[model samples]
Target: MAVKPNQTTILLILRIFQSLFAVLVLALSSFVAHWYNTTTVVSSPSQINFLIFIAIFSILSVTSLVILPRVFSNRAVANPYILLGIEIKNVLFWFAGWVALAVFLSRLLFCRGSVCHAAQADVAFAAMAWICWAGSAGIAAVGVFKGVKKSSGNNVEVPSGGVKPEAVEKEAV
Candidate 1:
């Protein structure tokens, strides 16, 4: 029988995919930016620069979130709320970056070169990265909600000026 992977394993896989997509976006956007800088009178578009920034930020964020915990087993890197917040922000940044790049590409009247193709690939990879971030955010949100519910349900009510039953029992013994 094959062993089924748990939620943590699935989340780790998703993070790996997110990292790969971010790397691809970084490389492709860097290529297009360099091409424009060297070959064209106009500088690289602002959208490309934005994508580059997003890619670098995503790579660093994922590295810190996923890898740091393993390397430093004793230290707690971040709480669940912080992780969810970062995932949400990444989703928004990636969405804006890819949409801006797509718009810039669409505005070009005549795009028929390697640089143009590279830009198109960059947009695709950015979109994929956005999807991954969104997925991660959704998962994180669910986990946070579940944790809240579990903690709340475990609360034990005590009467006024009275200790918990377990505490009273321990004192009596």
Candidate 2:
């Protein structure tokens, strides 16, 4: 369910710009992480590689955020599945994925490179991840709900000068 190119140009541009910004953020974070990697650890896990770990996750985040969305938006793809469409559904799914990635990254940051003490957090990562994942799924799921039926059962309500469904029904009767 890809949208025509003519209709999606603006959306595509906006998405590209967003991707660029995200990648830039990851790049800056990577620089910081690399700097962190050069420092000595004072804890039991003297062999810790926190910077490398963050760098890997940053790469993964950038891939999921930028590359996946572009792939989903491209019209050349032949997948016709409604759930995987490039319309509102795909956008929502992409948005959710981005949000989840952000939450995960934030949790990583909260750990502050102390792998052994990461589990001590009370309400940062645990609750945030669930909230992000569920919210995303709900938004994309609405598209599925819309596809279930073309229209709602309610009749259209028109203004005084407009054609009225009730009057039309009376005339037909």
Candidate 3:
């Protein structure tokens, strides 16, 4: 199926924002974790580490999805089902990562200093990143559903008389 130019442009814009938000989350979370490890006796919270992991994973996966199709121009790389699957996976992971980070931040009795502020910013960016991913997944889901509908519509059956629908319509005319 041919992709419309506008749809391609919109998806590209959404992906760019997703990448930017992921990078921002990564930077903030890393700063917070490093600050905790170097200045304080306690280790950084597990949520921060998970956020880092999600950011890294998103960056790598999104990069590959964007570049691989252009580089190889392979039909498999451009398959809508595969694209939908990856988008859905990212959506779920991003959702979990941000929620976990928010919960961890809420449990803190006092959040002060630059590190605390950075952690708060990380939560905000993580949530934004999740939104971007969800948008991508929604677009992919629509494309997949449309493709399924089109394929099914093409397979309409005739009656036992073997009269084509088009032929019946022409006879009526």
Best by TM-score: 1
lDDT for position 147 in model 2: 50
> Each candidate's TM vs. the true structure?
0.79, 0.31, 0.78
lDDT of 2 by residue, 133-173 (tens): 33433443453444533222455432212234445587799
- The C-alpha RMSD in Å for every predicted model, in order, reads 8.7, 13.9, 9.8
RMSD to the native, candidate 3? 9.8
Colliding pairs, model 3: none
Off by over 4 Å in 2: 1-7, 42-77, 80-173
Local distance difference test values of all predictions, in order: 0.81, 0.38, 0.80
- Per-residue lDDT of candidate 3, residues 1-173 (tens digit): 98667666777898899899888989999999999899989999899999999999999878976876555544577565776788888889888988998898899899999988898899888889888888878877876675433222356542221234455587799
Ranking by TM-score: 1, 3, 2
Q: 1 or 2, which is superior by lDDT?
A: 1
Per-structure clash totals for the candidates = 0, 0, 0
Q: Against the correct fold, how does model 2 do in TM-score?
A: 0.31
User: Model 3: how far is 163 from its true place, Å?
Assistant: 34
Descending-lDDT candidate ranking: 1, 3, 2
> lDDT value for candidate 2?
0.38
Off by over 4 Å in 1: 68-77, 148-173
